[model samples]
Target: MFRLVVACVLISVSLCDDLISVVVIYRHGDRTPIQPYPRDPYRNASYWPVGFGQLTNLGKQHHFQLGQWLRQRYGGFLSPHYSERDFYIRSTDVDRTLMSAEANLAGLYPPKADQVWDPTLPWQPIPVHTTPELEDNLLAMKKYCPKYNSLLTQLFKTEFFLNISRENRDLYAYLSKNSGAQIASLESLEYLYNTLYIESLNKFVLPDWTSGVYPEKMAPWARFSFATQCYTEELARLKTGPLFNEIVEHFRNATKNDGFRKFLVFSGHDVTIANVLNTMGAFEYHCPPYASTIMFELRRNSSFYLNIFYKNSTQVQKIALKGCDFDCDFDDFIRILKPVLITRKQWDLECQNSNFGDFNTIFIYSSIAIGFLISISLLWVIIACFKQVKTNSNDYTRLAIDEVA
Candidate 1:
């Protein structure tokens, strides 16, 4: 055991020495529930101090701590002064995630030199890039993709889902009765748990039924549901392909992009972390805790290598890839991901047509066919009316000639 520990430490040191770039994807910190169950006591946004889905002071502190940890881990490697050229940050356009990134940056880079505008405040503003919430496809899972939706429907009917649901039937019944909402499915049950967990965390008194076994059982159920949602090779690829593609693109372009930043930070949700981890075969059965993070460091070993590290709440562990070691060759990593990874263009195409069916193309063809039939009918009507008018005029002429004779 002692030798093993020492060897692990030496390997970590070697990897750190060769580290060339990093990408950190993290969940936003604690926040008020985005919504509440129908029968919950705290259904209104007014119940929380920060309103619905906004970050609280505690959340700020959580992210601030995370930022400080990042600094401690990479401070020696990063420039002492904050540089736009050295670091880049992006987050979901939502309030909590965007705020979390800002809070994190506050801890990551404090004011230095003439950068200090006011001695009273040690913090400085850092720009975070984001698209409008409606247009956002990377972090927020709200983007509408018909193919993904269809795939998810098919997933729910698979044997895996059936087995898990059968096993948890009793738990589902209990949750439905006690969770103050009708739990129609595992996804609905998860919503109830999320509300209960957040409300309880905010010091709201939970119902007597949720005291002990309920939470324990519900936690696993939640993880199982989440895992089933994206565990399959195909499901993970479709749901998280864009994010995976973005990370790889950043790494691949590191050499070509001018003034390449050493760090790329993504502030996102628990789903984001879980799905990405699942794709890499590094997922834990537990749902990622608030402020959880996964760090992928690209290192220049004999050949370039990718080292993936996962942190849940506090403990950070090295995650071995499915087909490779913990520190896998970058080329090998890319090859392993090739089947799952997709380009932005391919993603758009898949969204329109998943090969199962092309709804967009079908809709277009159906519209054209309907339009052609309508045009032909209108032309026939016009020709018939013109012939009737000419026939009436000729009859009138014949009557006039008879009267003149």
Candidate 2:
């Protein structure tokens, strides 16, 4: 293990002639939740001005720094001057992800020559192509990450049961009104919220609305479903997205690929970063916290052999992968790549959810359940009134009728 690591270190320390292209998959900066549940402690919107889980200004700086590092690392390959042909970027159409790409480009390119504006103006916009989250080009889902699936199946199975719950249905009305969405379930709610802010940044706030404490009595899938949705969205996207195909084609036609793509930056979420590594056969990285990024460093050996170094961009900087020597065989690399992404959720389970206890979980979940039920009951009572029901199809109308009728 140590020898392999040494080899990776050596690879990072030098450049190889065989190194032609780079693919960097990165996570977007910090963000807040889309909004708080009415029961949430942080629901008051004061919890975050950008509002829970949205990117802060600090995150912008981080990407800018990374961009500078990239410019320094691949000095010659990329043009000092702006040419549309020189660099290409892609994001997941999320606000933070796309914006981070823009930030990184700002630092990397620095708006050379005619690209620069007034002395006061800064950070020229760089193009970062993207597709919808469900339609993102580079994505994968491992069919068999035991822990992730265990949590997932539990989540899905639990959500199936939640559909029958009175509380969930009632709460849906209140949230639906606020979000202008029909959030029938947690996954739907999460998707609605995740995309809304990812696409419309200024409209939302960033830490998120999570109270960091769920209600005391939680429903079976209440906690699990949100987690599952977060995990599964990437998986579903990967299999169907164009990114994997793009990689396959890129390797197939190496000489035509751009050298200036020193880093194949992918601005996405932690789940995205984790799955990309897992898809590529580095099944060891599990992401924790918001804006977690997994780094894949590609370099050439002394003998001009190709290699890879996998790092999770975190405080400890976990090395889940070592020298992935392709030995000039793209086929070998793809084989490794496919499995790593496929099983990423398993690694995430290890890195993030390995040590949960019954007592704390029970307390947390119970509190959530109690809060959810109370709010739901309030909505339900409002919905239950006949006078409003007779005049309108809207749940909000019924809620209003409760007081009048």
Candidate 3:
């Protein structure tokens, strides 16, 4: 009986899955609106202490709490002290994202003993890398991709979006009149909605006109607008592909024992979270709240497996990929996402290609290419002629010298 009980305990231990690595992508904490609409009552910088779109004290607290929760959840897996080899962090170039990462790090790796730089402050600096927003294709997704813009424009012109625009024409006109801004498309409407939502969250009294359709009528459209950025497979490939590809590469590296890093953190915006969730086919139409996080955990029992989680509220809920189980085999996870997984080279090619129903773009590129070729050919001909002329000149000189001799 003792031997049997011991055997059962060992078997149970062997069957349990062990988490090996984690990748967390999260939205920045709360912030003031990016910009006020034309007629916003609280448009003055005085109303927002830190000015436009900057993270607030509340935002700092939110991220610090989130970091604490992360430390609690991953205490066993992660090192107690900050180690460059064990953890990595990256944020978009935006000030809010950068500040949020710093606040989160303050909680995640609070100084202890010899690591303490300032004992009074109880905090230590940790590196958070970033690229310029315009050049960042990985996190910000703001890199200029003409093809992506072209695809989005085409998507807006589709019958479904057209119908939505026609249906919301009255609402758009009403908003435009009240806000003193042109609210024509869902995109424009979403921007207004976001500003108003942020103002409301900050306890600013909204104008009377907002009562008619502030959230009830406009919220759905605003949430749906997030979906439009990555509505199609092509858009997903261009928008979220680089980040997802990087995540998968990290997992692959861990499986092969190629990298020592076990924790990766990405601080970005709501749209960043939305894009990732949408690409994973797990997004539902709702604004990802401030400081919301998506975790990709790699674990091993006998073989490797993946478990995805979303923490929008206090609870972190398991989110399975569409057509995949909650605890999915690593190989199966890769196979399922293979269709959406895009390499950096493929993303670049797709972004530069004008094959997506944009004849004008195609014509412009073709003209550039033809002009380049023609210019090169003309230069080559000119150089050849000059060389031939010099050769003839040399021959004539040699002939004259022979006659003289």
Best by lDDT: 3
RMSD of 3: 6.5
- C-alpha TM-score for every candidate: 0.85, 0.54, 0.86
Q: Please give, for residues 135-225, the per-residue lDDT of candidate 1 as tens digits.
A: 6666675667777778888888889878877987887777777666777677777777787888888889886777854477777777766
Residue runs of model 1 more than 4 Å from their true location after superposition: 1-16, 42-47, 166-170, 255-259, 358-405
Evaluated at residue 185, the lDDT of candidate 1 is 74
Candidate 2 structure quality by residue, lDDT tens digits, 195-278? 433433443333332212112222233423433333443433333234555554444444444444444566776666544444
* Alpha carbon lDDT at 104, candidate 3: 95
lDDT of 3 by residue, 236-332 (tens): 8889988888888899999999965899999999999888888888999988999999988887767888878899967667789877887778888
| Candidate 3: residue 353 Cα off by (Å) | 0.5
Reference-based TM-score, model 1: 0.85
Better of 2 and 3 by TM-score: 3
Q: Candidate 1's C-alpha lDDT?
A: 0.80
The CA lDDT of each predicted structure is 0.80, 0.52, 0.86
Ranking by TM-score: 3, 1, 2
RMSD of each: 4.3, 18.6, 6.5
Weakest 10 consecutive residues, lDDT, candidate 1?
Answer: 1-10
